[model samples]
Target: MAEGRSIAERLSGAMERRDEAPNIALAEEIGASGDKAAVGELVELVRIGTARQRNDAMKVLYEIGARNPDLIGGYCPVFLEALGSRTNRQVWGAMQVLDSVAELRADEIAAELPRIIEAADRGSVIAKDRCTSLLTKLARSGYAEKAVPILVERLKTAAPNQFPTYAEQTASVVRPAEKPGLIETIRKRLETITQRAKRERMEKLLRKLNG
Candidate 1:
């Protein structure tokens, strides 16, 4: 007595529903699919679907990446485009998805060099750090020269004043299990940078003025 269709069939029917809940359900089923057909559907979900639906699709795609390495590579552009909108939680989710995707599809997404560079240069520290880590992984995987320029540019653009605030905020939000040494580590790292290095240094001095 079959109470429901197989995951693939249910996913196919769900894809036609146009509702967010069905789209999300389809994403879940696709994760279960791990079959070749799920790749295109997952890509569309990330590209044009609702944010929740995109996150779900990204999760499935990341799971698929475990077996079909190229599944994530095919959507790097869409992932990067989503990341450009920093205010969206979906953007952050996309980044996490990209990290997994890059781990699996390292060679294929090498073409994302420019976006990777820009990401390291201008995004929030957490964002830049994640981009830096991905580029570092890419380097270790055999693109050292390609990743170096991006890393160097990122270091060059990072502001000294922003580092203190970044350290403080990071310390406050970091999990209690991590707070003991993480705050000190971030503070020490930020303190070593030259204040004259960036315009944001003035912000740090202003703090002294108010103090």
Candidate 2:
């Protein structure tokens, strides 16, 4: 609130606020302004701030990325580094940012597939969800040959509640040669999916793929 207070000082952690509304409002403000300097400060905060500070910084960064990914596109390294963080919030927040910019920075993301996949394998549901989204985006952005197989692997092992959505998302990008394999994976999983809606959705996907 004081004049000349740095962006870091204004963050929720720095201000010692328990609520995230201020942080969300700040993210919207910074995102709308397209202030690269603020983005730089936020990135630095993610690197060296306290646990709460790091969380707030990541929240703001991803919110900015969501509004205008190009504004955060060049910070792929920062995001990648956050994947290795001890803090779960930082990891998932970074994944959200990476997902937002995956298509815009496809080459950079393609080069970091191993790290991304590793993070997804050990990460929370939100992190895995975003990784799935990132892979699908890459699959559509000329990396289908490399991304589709990984996507299929993820689909096979996805949580039953999430399988139908993952299957639906992967369906559009699958090549003809991949269809039968996907269909088979879906069919095998169908028995485990007790929810009528989900089973029906996967069955629908199978029908579409079969035609």
Candidate 3:
């Protein structure tokens, strides 16, 4: 089998050919081997691989998330942005990779909430769902409250298609856990609105008194 070489070597060879099987195998081996040596190669793959290859490399990074989440987490924003810009169906796979990376590297990406929301707001339906889900996760995980404004904006300006998906994600992805239906999400979103209104009202009252 010409494929025979240490897993790293085989993957290097495969990367030269842009071969899928070898890339997939290399991804698996890197995860299993926890080889720090492979990190540079993986990052390079992220830079140069075709859409499929880029997505595949991301999966490897996510798998490596199981071992060194910090390293894996560091790449989430880059991959997320890159994947979001893409229109191919393969972007779904990239979204999945982002999801896994977000889970593992929760702490690292926590500070990028606003950017995440902006990305979601600009994304396709599926990309928006994935980003919103991760945002909800980050919020629940105690990342920050910055995402609230974006969510509110989405609910406000949502089109027919966008609103339903946004509503579904609010139910399925934003909450602490998956809720059964849209009613619950609606209820929760209403609660969020009420809270924001209260805060705004208080600020208005404060301005009147200070004036």
Candidate 4:
């Protein structure tokens, strides 16, 4: 006999169970839902369910966003609203979803950039990671006029552990016109980056950009 219900069935059931911990496989199951109306169910959960349910639902929605962002791209507002959840999980989790859908929904997100930055600053390191990444994604997708400077400013003050990873992605998005300003911004911070590991990473990135 089969050991359990189908993933979709289990996820559907899990969505209604507000008192219990969410099913770990819910995100994967949401992806397996063929990018359909089942997404609305996940959206509803994120909008009104308990905190654990909302967190899991956000995870499921972002899983869908990651696999086919167009599936959940229109729900950008839902994720944006959850940024204020009392729980940090929903807050940063929403940011992560926005990050996954940033390029796909850049027009919708462009106006919300400041709120995104504000949420990240008030939330956690995870929130900052995804928020900065979304800003870079928008800059890459053509909001460079308004987006690149914010990305550069964030890079200037990012924690040491972040310089290597986040800067790598941000570097790839710097347009030729923006490169000079970005390089100068990073170089100005180099004299202040006291961490050897982070300083080395910034130097390496600058070499590639300067070259």
User: Per-residue CA lDDT of candidate 1, range 1-211, in tens?
Assistant: 0235533333323456444454345444454554455677667867776655565565556555544555456677777787766544555555655666665567755677676556545556555555655665665666655654444334434566554443333332334444444433444455566655532443453343334
Best by the lDDT measure: 2
Instruction: State which candidate, 1 or 2, has the greater TM-score.
Output: 2
Q: What is the per-residue lDDT of model 4 for residues 41-93, given as tens digits with 9 covering 90 to 100? A: 77887888766556666767776777777778888898889887778988888
Query: Considering only N, C-alpha and C atoms within 3 Å, which residue pairs clash in candidate 1?
Result: none
Local distance difference test values of all predictions, in order? 0.54, 0.88, 0.54, 0.77
User: Candidate 4, after superposition: displacement of residue 137 in Å?
Assistant: 1.5
Clashes (backbone N, CA, C under 3 Å), per candidate, total 0, 0, 0, 0
Error of 4 at 206 (Å): 1.5
The parts of candidate 4 lying over 4 Å away from their true place are 1-24
Candidate 2, pairs of clashing residues: none
TM-score: which candidate is best?
2
Model 3, runs deviating above 4 Å: 1-25, 49-52, 62-71, 80-95, 103-108, 152-211
Candidates in order, TM-scores: namely 0.51, 0.96, 0.54, 0.82
Rank by TM-score, highest first.
2, 4, 3, 1
